[model samples]
Target: MITIRPSREGTAVAPVLVLAQITSLQLGSAVAKDAYDHVSPTALAGMRLTFSAMIMLVLVRPRLRQIIARQWRAVISLGLVFAAMNVAYFQAISHLQIGVASTLELLGPLMLSIVLSHRLEHLAAALLALTGVLLLTTSSASLSPLGILLGLLAGLCRAGYTVLNQQVGRLFPDWSGLAVAFAVGACVLAPVAAVTDAGAVAEHPAVLETGLGVALLSSLIPYALDMVVLRRIDTRTFGVLLALSPAAGAGVGLVVLHEHLSVRQACAIALVVLASAWSVSRSPRTAPVPSPAPVSAGDNLPIKDTEHQART
Candidate 1:
């Protein structure tokens, strides 16, 4: 994934990484959704974060004492954001269809892009995205208000994670900030989940396995790819490609959760996609720079380079 010169070859790789990141995250969400009956969302989220943290810790073994003193505040904040975003997303999927939940959550990044870009096209895209979200949610009266709220909350967390993670990435080595954040998030959630939902895992080891799978697919591989590919793409292009994630989530939900999308909803998704693509195609080119590499989890996962992708 190393690109010595920022050329067309390097640019071509960015979208592929983002696409892979989207696919892995949505598939992981389906797996986590399937496990919800045996384990509560909180428990599943806690387990996923804890297990990912453990894997990363074992692999990275960051110099905690030195790193902590250097950037403990940002590290701890990023971890909390990660934990909250995952919990909110799971809660949303519990009440709403995964497609709708994911579509709603994209609001965070859409808004972020608008704020950061300050481009009329981005503003137009945000409006288009809002229109799409309205189409997706209003068409189905069965959707839960609480679930939609939770998804929006998760989106907000995601936006914050993107902003803060950029700072943390600048402060630490490859994946070290992420390792610490995951460890901190795991430390925060594991005990509460253990006391409340330990029996679910004890009774069914499959839940643990599923969570581990989620961590691997959702957190480890995609984020690693994200770290590499992001350096070759500008933030504008990266954010625009992010429009693919909701569509991917919707597709995964249809296949896995048997969630169906209406014609209007599909149109809505398309509008958001078009808005992003249009904005990206119009934007002036910027030479990409290789940024720090870090592994992160789902939406709340630290995006060490470019914009942070939404966590499921």
Candidate 2:
């Protein structure tokens, strides 16, 4: 029998890299939140996407020619979704706590998983997540209704991104599709950037640096690390680790943003995380093996077919 196992390097590197990715993402959001005093939410969002797109374009240099005419719709849709998600995310954090916003936005992918799931465990998981989100949203007074709406909208856009990313990933290689999608996001936000008083961002050297840091930390570094980490870990392990995102957000929010969560809110976040892990754990693993082919009526046998059957 042949045995296959995860490589030693993968075993050691995957978890650490994923942790780093989560840390970078949450820390980047914290930095963006701090910079809000200097720039509008939309302006900051535009700066992040625009600069990140420029960086990705220079590094990836995606070949536009490789994208077929038929795939234009998918490419454009993915880009639009990306732009919408980020814009709503920034707007959400401006009004809501970073942790709260992230947890609510997580509803998108969680609901998507539940909708497509066939297992009872996954359904249970969905309910758990839903309850958690409701608790978090209802218990908070500081968050405005518009902020909550934007967070949910961001979640919906996130679900769209998840669905479309698979299609475009198949259509392009070397992550060029993501680069193209980012480019499209940059284009989509160009008007917003032009209209916003970006001069405030320009005048403050610290804000500009923070904007660049947000771009690199939030988009470029984490995404680049994700590509590498995905190749090194199994789907189950990856999904399980991804469940830590909300916790990471909350932890970072407390430390960096000084956002405090009540006991009930903390429990709700735990429920959401557990639900994500449970859903991933309950996914159908290996496929059932096929039965052996039936013996032909006319096939010669060591013993007669009837006699052999009786003996067995």
Clash pairs (backbone) in predicted model 2: none
Error of 2 at 236 (Å): 11
Q: lDDT by residue for model 1 over 1-312, one digit each (tens)? A: 333334465566666777898899889889999988899988888888898899999998887655544367888998899889888988898998887888777778767776767667766766676677667767787778899899999889877766566566655657777888888888888887888899988999888889999888777776556555545554445555677777888999999888888888888789767875776555544444545443322224333333333122
As a TM-score, model 2 comes out at: 0.79
Tens-digit per-residue lDDT, 1-312, candidate 2: 222333456645666787798789889899999988888888777878888888888988876765555456777898898789889999999988888887778777667766765657766777777777778667767678898899999878867766676555444546676788878998998678658856876677677677789998887787667655544444334434454567788899999989888998888878777866675555443322111122333434422212012321
How many residue pairs clash per model? Answer: 4, 0
Whole-model lDDT per candidate: 0.74, 0.70
Worst 10 residues of 2 by lDDT: 303-312
